[model samples]
Target chain A: MPIDLDEALKAIAHPVRRDMLSWLKDPQRHFPDQEHPLEIGVCAGQFDQRTGLSQSTVSAHLATLQRACLVTSRRVGQWNFFKRNQAAIDELVRRLGEEL
Target chain B: MPIDLDEALKAIAHPVRRDMLSWLKDPQRHFPDQEHPLEIGVCAGQFDQRTGLSQSTVSAHLATLQRACLVTSRRVGQWNFFKRNQAAIDELVRRLGEEL
Candidate 1:
Protein backbone atom coordinates (compact mmCIF):
# COMPACT_ATOMS: atom_id res chain seq x y z
CA MET A 1 0.00 0.00 0.00
CA PRO A 2 1.13 3.53 -0.79
CA ILE A 3 2.19 5.44 2.30
CA ASP A 4 -0.02 8.32 3.43
CA LEU A 5 2.40 11.13 4.11
CA ASP A 6 -0.09 13.24 6.09
CA GLU A 7 -1.16 10.30 8.22
CA ALA A 8 2.44 9.27 8.81
CA LEU A 9 3.35 12.78 9.87
CA LYS A 10 0.40 12.92 12.27
CA ALA A 11 1.20 9.47 13.61
CA ILE A 12 4.76 10.35 14.57
CA ALA A 13 3.82 13.69 16.12
CA HIS A 14 3.31 12.07 19.50
CA PRO A 15 6.25 10.97 21.67
CA VAL A 16 4.76 7.60 22.59
CA ARG A 17 4.06 6.74 18.97
CA ARG A 18 7.55 7.77 17.93
CA ASP A 19 9.07 5.78 20.79
CA MET A 20 7.05 2.76 19.70
CA LEU A 21 8.64 2.98 16.25
CA SER A 22 12.10 3.31 17.79
CA TRP A 23 11.55 0.25 19.97
CA LEU A 24 10.17 -1.79 17.08
CA LYS A 25 13.28 -0.98 15.05
CA ASP A 26 15.19 -3.52 17.18
CA PRO A 27 12.70 -5.95 18.65
CA GLN A 28 15.27 -8.45 19.84
CA ARG A 29 17.11 -5.83 21.83
CA HIS A 30 14.05 -4.00 23.11
CA PHE A 31 11.68 -6.88 23.66
CA PRO A 32 13.88 -9.63 25.05
CA ASP A 33 11.08 -11.39 26.91
CA GLN A 34 9.04 -12.26 23.84
CA GLU A 35 8.85 -16.04 23.18
CA HIS A 36 8.25 -15.53 19.46
CA PRO A 37 11.21 -14.70 17.26
CA LEU A 38 11.81 -11.20 15.87
CA GLU A 39 10.65 -12.40 12.44
CA ILE A 40 7.04 -12.07 13.55
CA GLY A 41 7.96 -8.81 15.29
CA VAL A 42 7.20 -7.93 18.93
CA CYS A 43 3.89 -8.91 20.40
CA ALA A 44 1.41 -6.26 21.57
CA GLY A 45 1.65 -7.47 25.16
CA GLN A 46 5.36 -6.79 25.13
CA PHE A 47 4.69 -3.20 24.10
CA ASP A 48 2.25 -2.77 26.98
CA GLN A 49 4.84 -4.04 29.37
CA ARG A 50 7.69 -2.04 27.87
CA THR A 51 5.75 1.22 27.74
CA GLY A 52 4.06 0.64 31.10
CA LEU A 53 0.86 1.77 29.47
CA SER A 54 -2.50 0.05 29.41
CA GLN A 55 -3.06 -2.58 26.77
CA SER A 56 -5.85 -0.55 25.15
CA THR A 57 -3.72 2.56 25.11
CA VAL A 58 -0.78 0.73 23.53
CA SER A 59 -3.07 -0.91 21.05
CA ALA A 60 -4.56 2.44 20.10
CA HIS A 61 -1.11 3.91 19.53
CA LEU A 62 -0.09 0.87 17.48
CA ALA A 63 -3.27 1.20 15.45
CA THR A 64 -2.41 4.82 14.69
CA LEU A 65 1.08 3.83 13.48
CA GLN A 66 -0.38 1.00 11.43
CA ARG A 67 -2.92 3.36 9.91
CA ALA A 68 -0.08 5.65 8.87
CA CYS A 69 1.74 2.69 7.28
CA LEU A 70 4.66 3.34 9.59
CA VAL A 71 4.15 -0.09 11.16
CA THR A 72 2.69 -3.42 10.15
CA SER A 73 0.82 -5.81 12.42
CA ARG A 74 -0.04 -9.50 12.21
CA ARG A 75 -2.44 -11.53 14.32
CA VAL A 76 -0.82 -14.70 15.63
CA GLY A 77 -3.83 -16.60 16.99
CA GLN A 78 -4.46 -14.51 20.15
CA TRP A 79 -1.66 -11.97 20.14
CA ASN A 80 -0.88 -9.29 17.59
CA PHE A 81 2.70 -8.73 16.45
CA PHE A 82 4.01 -5.45 15.04
CA LYS A 83 7.13 -4.43 13.16
CA ARG A 84 8.38 -1.30 11.51
CA ASN A 85 7.30 -0.84 7.93
CA GLN A 86 10.80 0.14 6.87
CA ALA A 87 10.00 0.63 3.19
CA ALA A 88 7.17 3.06 3.85
CA ILE A 89 9.32 4.86 6.38
CA ASP A 90 12.15 5.16 3.86
CA GLU A 91 9.78 6.47 1.21
CA LEU A 92 8.39 9.00 3.70
CA VAL A 93 11.87 10.29 4.44
CA ARG A 94 12.73 10.43 0.72
CA ARG A 95 9.56 12.26 -0.17
CA LEU A 96 10.01 14.68 2.74
CA GLY A 97 13.53 15.42 1.50
CA GLU A 98 12.32 16.15 -2.03
CA GLU A 99 8.91 17.62 -1.37
CA LEU A 100 9.04 19.22 2.10
CA MET B 1 19.08 26.54 17.23
CA PRO B 2 18.33 22.84 17.27
CA ILE B 3 15.36 21.68 15.25
CA ASP B 4 12.47 20.30 17.32
CA LEU B 5 11.61 17.06 15.56
CA ASP B 6 8.33 16.57 17.42
CA GLU B 7 7.22 20.12 16.78
CA ALA B 8 8.20 19.95 13.12
CA LEU B 9 6.28 16.72 12.70
CA LYS B 10 3.25 18.25 14.43
CA ALA B 11 3.43 21.39 12.31
CA ILE B 12 3.52 19.51 9.02
CA ALA B 13 0.66 17.26 10.07
CA HIS B 14 -1.85 19.84 8.90
CA PRO B 15 -2.41 20.04 5.13
CA VAL B 16 -2.39 23.84 5.00
CA ARG B 17 0.85 24.01 6.92
CA ARG B 18 2.42 21.39 4.63
CA ASP B 19 1.21 23.33 1.60
CA MET B 20 2.67 26.47 3.11
CA LEU B 21 6.09 24.82 3.35
CA SER B 22 5.78 23.54 -0.23
CA TRP B 23 4.92 27.05 -1.40
CA LEU B 24 7.77 28.69 0.51
CA LYS B 25 10.22 26.22 -1.04
CA ASP B 26 10.18 28.32 -4.23
CA PRO B 27 9.12 31.80 -3.22
CA GLN B 28 9.50 33.46 -6.60
CA ARG B 29 7.42 30.75 -8.24
CA HIS B 30 4.81 30.19 -5.49
CA PHE B 31 4.54 33.80 -4.49
CA PRO B 32 4.79 36.67 -6.95
CA ASP B 33 3.66 40.32 -7.24
CA GLN B 34 5.44 41.26 -4.04
CA GLU B 35 7.33 44.55 -3.93
CA HIS B 36 10.26 43.08 -2.00
CA PRO B 37 12.77 40.59 -3.44
CA LEU B 38 13.20 36.94 -2.51
CA GLU B 39 15.93 37.87 -0.03
CA ILE B 40 13.25 38.80 2.49
CA GLY B 41 11.20 35.75 1.52
CA VAL B 42 7.43 35.96 0.75
CA CYS B 43 5.40 38.48 2.66
CA ALA B 44 2.57 37.19 4.88
CA GLY B 45 0.05 39.12 2.78
CA GLN B 46 0.75 36.94 -0.23
CA PHE B 47 -0.04 33.88 1.84
CA ASP B 48 -3.38 35.35 2.85
CA GLN B 49 -4.16 36.06 -0.80
CA ARG B 50 -3.04 32.65 -2.03
CA THR B 51 -4.78 30.72 0.69
CA GLY B 52 -7.86 32.96 0.73
CA LEU B 53 -7.69 32.81 4.50
CA SER B 54 -7.99 35.66 6.98
CA GLN B 55 -4.79 37.41 7.94
CA SER B 56 -5.11 36.26 11.54
CA THR B 57 -5.69 32.67 10.47
CA VAL B 58 -2.72 32.84 8.13
CA SER B 59 -0.63 34.35 10.87
CA ALA B 60 -1.62 31.53 13.22
CA HIS B 61 -0.60 28.93 10.68
CA LEU B 62 2.70 30.71 10.03
CA ALA B 63 3.29 30.92 13.76
CA THR B 64 2.79 27.18 14.06
CA LEU B 65 5.35 26.55 11.34
CA GLN B 66 7.76 29.01 12.92
CA ARG B 67 7.40 27.33 16.31
CA ALA B 68 8.28 24.03 14.62
CA CYS B 69 11.42 25.58 13.07
CA LEU B 70 10.17 24.39 9.72
CA VAL B 71 9.98 28.02 8.58
CA THR B 72 11.61 31.23 9.71
CA SER B 73 10.17 34.72 9.55
CA ARG B 74 11.68 38.20 9.45
CA ARG B 75 9.87 41.38 10.39
CA VAL B 76 10.26 43.55 7.33
CA GLY B 77 8.78 46.77 8.70
CA GLN B 78 5.13 45.93 9.48
CA TRP B 79 5.05 42.73 7.38
CA ASN B 80 6.69 39.42 8.13
CA PHE B 81 8.61 37.68 5.35
CA PHE B 82 8.63 33.93 5.80
CA LYS B 83 10.92 31.35 4.23
CA ARG B 84 11.82 27.70 4.56
CA ASN B 85 14.71 26.82 6.86
CA GLN B 86 16.42 24.54 4.38
CA ALA B 87 19.24 23.53 6.70
CA ALA B 88 16.91 22.57 9.51
CA ILE B 89 14.71 20.78 7.00
CA ASP B 90 17.68 18.85 5.63
CA GLU B 91 18.78 17.96 9.13
CA LEU B 92 15.26 16.85 9.94
CA VAL B 93 15.18 14.49 6.97
CA ARG B 94 18.62 13.13 7.81
CA ARG B 95 17.67 12.59 11.42
CA LEU B 96 14.40 10.97 10.47
CA GLY B 97 16.30 8.56 8.27
CA GLU B 98 18.40 7.51 11.24
CA GLU B 99 16.07 8.04 14.16
CA LEU B 100 12.55 7.44 12.89
Candidate 2:
Protein backbone atom coordinates (compact mmCIF):
# COMPACT_ATOMS: atom_id res chain seq x y z
CA MET A 1 0.00 0.00 0.00
CA PRO A 2 1.08 3.58 -0.64
CA ILE A 3 2.17 5.47 2.47
CA ASP A 4 -0.40 7.99 3.59
CA LEU A 5 1.08 11.27 2.36
CA ASP A 6 -0.96 13.49 4.67
CA GLU A 7 -0.02 11.51 7.75
CA ALA A 8 3.62 11.32 6.70
CA LEU A 9 3.77 15.05 6.09
CA LYS A 10 2.08 15.72 9.39
CA ALA A 11 4.55 13.46 11.19
CA ILE A 12 7.48 15.11 9.49
CA ALA A 13 6.33 18.72 9.78
CA HIS A 14 7.67 19.18 13.29
CA PRO A 15 11.25 20.57 13.33
CA VAL A 16 12.59 18.19 15.97
CA ARG A 17 11.11 15.11 14.32
CA ARG A 18 12.56 16.15 10.96
CA ASP A 19 15.95 16.54 12.59
CA MET A 20 15.45 13.23 14.37
CA LEU A 21 15.22 11.41 11.03
CA SER A 22 18.38 13.11 9.77
CA TRP A 23 20.23 12.37 13.00
CA LEU A 24 19.13 8.74 13.10
CA LYS A 25 20.24 8.25 9.50
CA ASP A 26 23.83 7.99 10.71
CA PRO A 27 23.59 6.31 14.08
CA GLN A 28 27.27 5.48 14.37
CA ARG A 29 28.24 9.13 13.96
CA HIS A 30 25.53 10.73 16.07
CA PHE A 31 24.34 8.49 18.90
CA PRO A 32 26.10 6.74 21.78
CA ASP A 33 26.80 3.03 21.63
CA GLN A 34 23.69 1.07 22.51
CA GLU A 35 23.59 -1.34 25.41
CA HIS A 36 22.02 -3.82 23.03
CA PRO A 37 23.56 -4.37 19.58
CA LEU A 38 23.32 -1.08 17.67
CA GLU A 39 22.11 -2.91 14.57
CA ILE A 40 18.72 -3.30 16.22
CA GLY A 41 18.42 0.50 16.61
CA VAL A 42 19.27 3.38 18.91
CA CYS A 43 17.65 3.26 22.32
CA ALA A 44 14.98 5.85 23.14
CA GLY A 45 17.04 7.02 26.08
CA GLN A 46 19.77 8.14 23.72
CA PHE A 47 17.26 9.96 21.55
CA ASP A 48 15.77 11.60 24.58
CA GLN A 49 19.21 12.76 25.71
CA ARG A 50 20.43 13.95 22.29
CA THR A 51 17.14 15.72 21.63
CA GLY A 52 17.31 17.46 25.00
CA LEU A 53 13.65 16.62 25.39
CA SER A 54 11.83 14.94 28.23
CA GLN A 55 11.23 11.17 28.00
CA SER A 56 7.51 11.74 27.53
CA THR A 57 8.07 14.27 24.73
CA VAL A 58 10.48 11.96 22.92
CA SER A 59 8.04 9.10 23.21
CA ALA A 60 5.25 11.21 21.75
CA HIS A 61 7.42 12.27 18.82
CA LEU A 62 8.59 8.73 18.13
CA ALA A 63 5.01 7.46 18.33
CA THR A 64 3.99 9.99 15.69
CA LEU A 65 6.86 8.95 13.43
CA GLN A 66 5.94 5.29 13.89
CA ARG A 67 2.31 5.96 13.05
CA ALA A 68 3.41 7.58 9.78
CA CYS A 69 5.68 4.59 8.95
CA LEU A 70 8.62 6.97 8.66
CA VAL A 71 10.18 5.32 11.69
CA THR A 72 10.00 1.83 13.18
CA SER A 73 10.34 0.77 16.79
CA ARG A 74 11.24 -2.44 18.55
CA ARG A 75 11.47 -3.43 22.21
CA VAL A 76 14.23 -5.64 23.59
CA GLY A 77 14.10 -6.43 27.29
CA GLN A 78 12.72 -3.07 28.50
CA TRP A 79 14.32 -0.50 26.19
CA ASN A 80 12.66 0.84 23.05
CA PHE A 81 14.77 1.35 19.92
CA PHE A 82 13.94 3.48 16.90
CA LYS A 83 15.25 3.38 13.32
CA ARG A 84 14.21 5.03 10.11
CA ASN A 85 11.94 3.17 7.66
CA GLN A 86 13.80 3.91 4.42
CA ALA A 87 11.22 2.17 2.22
CA ALA A 88 8.41 4.33 3.52
CA ILE A 89 10.50 7.47 3.17
CA ASP A 90 11.40 6.57 -0.41
CA GLU A 91 7.77 5.81 -1.15
CA LEU A 92 6.88 9.31 0.04
CA VAL A 93 9.45 10.79 -2.33
CA ARG A 94 8.06 8.69 -5.18
CA ARG A 95 4.50 9.77 -4.43
CA LEU A 96 5.49 13.42 -4.23
CA GLY A 97 7.22 13.22 -7.59
CA GLU A 98 4.31 11.43 -9.23
CA GLU A 99 1.45 13.38 -7.66
CA LEU A 100 2.94 16.82 -6.98
CA MET B 1 17.21 31.46 0.68
CA PRO B 2 16.24 27.84 1.31
CA ILE B 3 12.56 27.02 1.16
CA ASP B 4 11.14 26.54 4.67
CA LEU B 5 10.71 22.75 4.66
CA ASP B 6 8.45 22.72 7.72
CA GLU B 7 6.07 25.29 6.28
CA ALA B 8 6.14 23.71 2.82
CA LEU B 9 5.40 20.26 4.21
CA LYS B 10 2.54 21.64 6.27
CA ALA B 11 1.11 23.47 3.26
CA ILE B 12 1.22 20.39 1.08
CA ALA B 13 -0.24 18.11 3.76
CA HIS B 14 -3.85 18.88 2.96
CA PRO B 15 -5.41 16.40 0.50
CA VAL B 16 -7.27 19.02 -1.53
CA ARG B 17 -4.19 21.23 -1.74
CA ARG B 18 -2.03 18.28 -2.81
CA ASP B 19 -4.49 17.46 -5.58
CA MET B 20 -4.61 21.11 -6.52
CA LEU B 21 -0.88 21.17 -7.26
CA SER B 22 -1.12 17.99 -9.36
CA TRP B 23 -4.11 19.34 -11.25
CA LEU B 24 -2.52 22.73 -11.86
CA LYS B 25 0.54 20.98 -13.30
CA ASP B 26 -1.10 20.51 -16.70
CA PRO B 27 -3.57 23.34 -16.96
CA GLN B 28 -4.52 22.53 -20.55
CA ARG B 29 -5.27 18.93 -19.65
CA HIS B 30 -7.32 19.70 -16.57
CA PHE B 31 -9.01 23.11 -16.91
CA PRO B 32 -10.97 24.99 -19.52
CA ASP B 33 -9.39 27.82 -21.56
CA GLN B 34 -9.12 30.96 -19.54
CA GLU B 35 -10.90 34.19 -20.47
CA HIS B 36 -7.37 35.49 -20.14
CA PRO B 37 -4.60 33.82 -22.16
CA LEU B 38 -3.57 30.34 -20.96
CA GLU B 39 0.14 31.04 -21.33
CA ILE B 40 0.14 33.12 -18.14
CA GLY B 41 -1.59 30.59 -15.79
CA VAL B 42 -4.94 29.33 -14.58
CA CYS B 43 -7.32 31.75 -12.94
CA ALA B 44 -8.50 31.13 -9.37
CA GLY B 45 -12.09 31.01 -10.57
CA GLN B 46 -11.42 27.77 -12.43
CA PHE B 47 -9.52 26.29 -9.48
CA ASP B 48 -12.37 27.19 -7.15
CA GLN B 49 -14.83 25.60 -9.57
CA ARG B 50 -12.83 22.43 -10.16
CA THR B 51 -11.95 21.91 -6.50
CA GLY B 52 -15.64 22.06 -5.44
CA LEU B 53 -14.46 24.31 -2.62
CA SER B 54 -15.66 27.70 -1.60
CA GLN B 55 -13.77 30.63 -3.10
CA SER B 56 -12.56 31.71 0.34
CA THR B 57 -11.29 28.20 1.15
CA VAL B 58 -9.47 27.93 -2.18
CA SER B 59 -7.90 31.31 -1.62
CA ALA B 60 -6.69 30.28 1.81
CA HIS B 61 -5.09 27.12 0.43
CA LEU B 62 -3.43 29.06 -2.40
CA ALA B 63 -2.09 31.60 0.05
CA THR B 64 -0.42 28.85 2.02
CA LEU B 65 1.14 27.38 -1.13
CA GLN B 66 2.34 30.83 -2.13
CA ARG B 67 3.83 31.44 1.30
CA ALA B 68 5.70 28.15 0.99
CA CYS B 69 6.98 29.19 -2.49
CA LEU B 70 5.46 26.02 -3.95
CA VAL B 71 3.21 28.19 -6.16
CA THR B 72 3.51 31.65 -7.68
CA SER B 73 0.89 34.11 -8.77
CA ARG B 74 0.70 36.89 -11.34
CA ARG B 75 -1.77 39.69 -11.86
CA VAL B 76 -2.81 40.84 -15.32
CA GLY B 77 -5.67 43.30 -15.72
CA GLN B 78 -7.87 42.11 -12.85
CA TRP B 79 -7.59 38.27 -12.78
CA ASN B 80 -5.08 36.37 -10.64
CA PHE B 81 -2.94 33.75 -12.37
CA PHE B 82 -1.24 30.87 -10.57
CA LYS B 83 1.44 28.42 -11.67
CA ARG B 84 3.81 26.00 -9.99
CA ASN B 85 7.24 27.20 -8.91
CA GLN B 86 9.27 24.23 -10.10
CA ALA B 87 12.51 25.51 -8.57
CA ALA B 88 10.95 25.74 -5.15
CA ILE B 89 9.40 22.29 -5.59
CA ASP B 90 12.80 20.86 -6.60
CA GLU B 91 14.38 22.50 -3.58
CA LEU B 92 11.75 20.89 -1.37
CA VAL B 93 12.55 17.51 -2.93
CA ARG B 94 16.26 18.04 -2.33
CA ARG B 95 15.70 19.00 1.30
CA LEU B 96 13.52 15.93 1.88
CA GLY B 97 16.15 13.59 0.42
CA GLU B 98 18.97 15.10 2.45
CA GLU B 99 17.12 15.69 5.70
CA LEU B 100 14.41 13.04 5.83
Please tell me what DockQ candidate 2 reaches. 0.81
Kindly list the per-residue Cα lDDT of model 1 for residues B1-100, writing each as its tens digit: 7788889898887888888999987788887788899888889999999999999999999999999888888997888999998888888888888788
Candidate 2 CAPRI grade? high
Question: DockQ of all candidates, in order?
Answer: 0.79, 0.81
> Which parts of model 1 have CA positions greater than 4 angstroms off?
none
Residue pairs whose backbone atoms clash in candidate 1: none
Error of 1 at B4 (Å): 1.4
Task: Summarize candidate 2's per-residue lDDT along B14-83 as a digit string, tens digits.
Answer: 9998888888788888886567777798898888889889999999999999999999999988878899
Tell how far residue B20 is off in model 2, in angstroms. 1.4
Looking at model 1 chain B, report the run of 10 residues with the lowest lDDT sum: B24-33
